[model samples]
Target: MAGSHGGSLKSWLAVIVILAGFTVGGVALCFGPNWPLVWAGAGIIAVGGVIALLVDIFSDVIVDAPRVLASEKVDRKG
Candidate 1:
């Protein structure tokens, strides 16, 4: 998967994590014995958010480096 299209697998996994977090969090918030379940859901969501951010950052860096380097080369040539 990683070799097929760069980091697509990680991105898809992150999305799955985010969706699961939202689903669990919403259900826990709606029906729970105590506040701990809600907090735990929030924590899951937070971790998903972090994973999402990291994936976005990594993808951006991977996508941008070649362009940046190419531009630098053009600048040097021009």
Candidate 2:
């Protein structure tokens, strides 16, 4: 079954960015000043924003590209 995450490249990148942010946050909390909370919060927000941006870009590209769908099997999977 197609659970949740379809495993699109964009989704993977988003996951990577979020994980990186948490890793950085961990380091910051351990060594840096209290600003890590602010930094991490902002970083998470920024990552979410970029993911949205990429979705927009992907949708634009999909729309602009030439394609014809005849059935559910022919639809864009990602």
Candidate 3:
């Protein structure tokens, strides 16, 4: 679905990876403040960030032109 208002599969995958990292970190903290696991989670998040950059996720973004309403039109009568 090119030009659709949604991210590509790769972008979605990266987002999922980042979310998983947050979950892992949260779980580790709730358990016993497991430093090792926490670090691992951070690493996972970093990897996801790298993936996002590599894929140029922002390149897929589409910005619509600004709309001009009829009521906002200026009168040129002098």
Compared with the true structure, all predictions reach lDDT values of 0.67, 0.63, 0.86
| Per-candidate RMSD, Å | 9.1, 11.7, 5.2
* Candidate 3 structure quality by residue, lDDT tens digits, 1-78: 654568689988888999999999899999999989999999999999999999898886655566676777677998
TM-score: model 2 vs. ground truth: 0.45
Where does model 1 exceed 4 Å of error?
1-7, 57-78
lDDT of 3 at 72: 75
lDDT per residue for candidate 2 within 2-67, as digits (tens), equals: 333245666557667767777777767777556857597568858866985776534432223345
Question: If the candidates were sorted by their lDDT against the true structure, best first, what order would they fall in?
Answer: 3, 1, 2
By TM-score: ranked, best first: 3, 1, 2
Off by over 4 Å in 3: 2-4, 64-78
Instruction: Give one clash count per candidate, in the order shown.
Output: 0, 0, 0
How high is the lDDT of residue 50 in model 3?
Answer: 93
Error of 3 at 39 (Å): 0.4
Q: Which stretches of candidate 2 lie over 4 Å from their true place?
A: 1-6, 34-41, 52-78
lDDT of 1 by residue, 1-78 (tens): 322435576677777787787777788777864477767767787887898898783563223232333444334554
- TM-score per model over all chains: 0.54, 0.45, 0.73
Which 10 consecutive residues of model 1 have the lowest summed lDDT? 60-69
User: Per-residue lDDT for 55 in model 2?
Assistant: 63
